[model samples]
Target: MYKILKKQKWSDTIYSNWIEAPFVAKAAQPGQFIILITNQKGERIPLTIADSNAKEGWVQIVYQVVGASTLELSLMNEGDSLYAFVGPLGIPSEVENFGGKVLIIGGGIGIAPIHPIAKKLKELGNYVVSIIGARTKDLIIMEDKMREASNELHIATDDGTYGQKGFVTNIMDDILKKESEAIKDIWAIGPPIMMKMCTRVANEHNKQIWVSLNSIMVDGTGMCGACRVSVGGKTKFACVDGPEFRGNLVNFDEMMLRQKQYCDQEREALMLLEEKIRRQASNG
Candidate 1:
């Protein structure tokens, strides 16, 4: 059993948990992920390694309650334990200093996964510039953490409730132009659509870009074939080959379509879970 050492509620739908998994923590890197099961009958839940402490034997995972499985996991507290937590899966992002300057972009919960990457890049003596976005001010998270990790940090919001009042791409475009000569690599993590747009921006600037595909991963292994994505017109499994890949080569349209394959079922499961919870509350 992997015990939850700490729990934090970022928002109504988002959460952060620190789990005691010594082996996984020791092997964790900036871009790997873990698959957790709430119980014997629970579905596998794949989440990126947001942060880790090797000495403490704890891995921090940030997740959003999107369906029944996640909602069930969120109900767990600091003292709770997960039935199974298997990880540091997938390839770690290339950590070498590329010249000197690199750009990091994060959208919503994607910010969590990018935090460690930004910190690591900074430690390697690279100038890290990070752009983080959410729908509004209330939705923004980990501002202090990202700022500490980055040499410079920019924020964007869809509703103008904080930072720039536009899509992150707007800021990305301007920054890429400003840093064109110095910036050589970029890392973006978020929704498929967001990453697609970021990739487009990076390509226009002629910079190498990597994006995370953990959202499409299922079963946390190549056996499921569910994380298959087209990269450079070839199939690659996100879990085994990478949860991170060259954004310029990924077929974002197909990946986004695959992400919705089980939406209806996910919605139904959430609805049923809500009904059950309401009944339990009423009975209690």
Candidate 2:
């Protein structure tokens, strides 16, 4: 059983947990994820490792409480134990000194997965510029960490409650217009729609863009075809092939549709669970 050592609420729907998992922490790399099960009957969920410390035997995971499994996870507190926490799974981000400016764009919880990538890029002596966005200022997270990892940081909010009153793509466009020559590559992670727009902007400017795809994953071991995505007109499994791919070549429209395949059922489940919980509380 993995124990939760710390917990922090980043926003109304986002949370971070520091869990005791020495082996996973020691082996984890940027872009790798883990499969966690809350209880014996709980469904496995894959979560990116936001940060880790091998020596301390701890790994941090940032998650959004979107589905029933994640909602249950959000309810877990410090000292709570998990039934299963298996991995440093999937391939790590390819970090190298590309020897030019790198721009990292992350939206909402996507910023969590980008944290380690940004840190590694900085360590490789690359000048990193980070752009993070959320629906509003209150929903923005890890601003201080991103700032420290990046040579320059930009923030955007859909509601204009933060640094720039626009989407992260707007910031990307501004950077492309002003610092086109300095930019070598762009890494983006966020909602499919956001990543799609970023890729479109980058491609229009002839900029190299990489995106992390987070489709609905179950086994997370590549055994399940649930996380399969089309890239460059070919089929690729997100679990084994990549959670990251060339943004311009990915079929974002199809991916977005596949991601919501179970939304109706998921919503129904959540509603039932909430009702049951409320009724139980009243009965008690």
Candidate 3:
């Protein structure tokens, strides 16, 4: 059992947890993820390695309460334990000092994964520009952390309650229009629609873009084709092959459809969990 060393509620539906998983922590890299099961009967869920301390034997995972497993996981506290913790799986983000500036774009909870990648790029002596966005100011997280890793940090929100009154793509558009020639590469992690739109903008500017796909994954290995996605007209698995791929080559529409494949079941499961919680609260 991996102990939950610490927990912090980031927003109304999002939380961060530091888990004591020595082996996984030791092997973790910027873009890899872990498959966790709350209990023996729980469903497997994949969460990105937001941050890690190999020597300290812990990995920080930032997750939003979107499904049954995540809701149950969020109810867990610092002293709780997870039934199974398997990872540092998937390919690590390619870290290289690409001649000029690197733009890291993250939307909502996607900011977590970009944290480590931004840090790595900075270490490689690349000029990092991080753009993080959420629906509102209350949803923004890890501001100081991202600032420390990036040379410049920009923030955006759908409702102007925070940094800028727009999406991360809007900021990207502005940057591209001004400094397109100096941008070496762009890395983005977010909802499929957002990433797809970002890809369109980047492609228009002829920028190289990399995106991470958080598709529905079962097993964190290639054997489970649940996370298969089409890239450049070919099939690829997000678990083993990548959670990262060239954004311009990805078929975002198809990916978006696959993501909604179990929405009905997911909604039912979440409703059941919430009802159970309400009943338990009343009984207590």
lDDT of 3 at 211: 97
Per-model TM values vs. the true structure? 0.98, 0.98, 0.98
Candidate 3: where are CA atoms >4 Å away? none
Badly placed stretches (over 4 Å) of model 1 are none
Q: Sort by lDDT, best first: what order?
A: 3, 2, 1
lDDT tens per residue, model 3, 92-181: 999999877999998999999989999999999999999999999989989999999999999999999999999999999999999999
Candidate 2 matches the true fold with a TM-score of 0.98
Better by TM-score, candidate 3 or 1: 3
**Higher-ranked by lDDT: 2 or 3:** 3
lDDT (Cα, tens digit) per residue for candidate 1, span 229-269: 99999999999988999999999999988889999999999
- Candidate 1, TM-score vs. the true structure? 0.98
Candidate 2 wrong stretches, greater than 4 Å: none
Best by TM-score: 3
Scored against the true structure, residue 41 in model 1 reaches a CA lDDT of 85
Provide the lowest-lDDT 10-residue window in model 1.
Answer: 214-223
How do the residues 243-274 of candidate 2 rate in per-residue lDDT, one tens digit apiece? 88899899999999999999999998789878
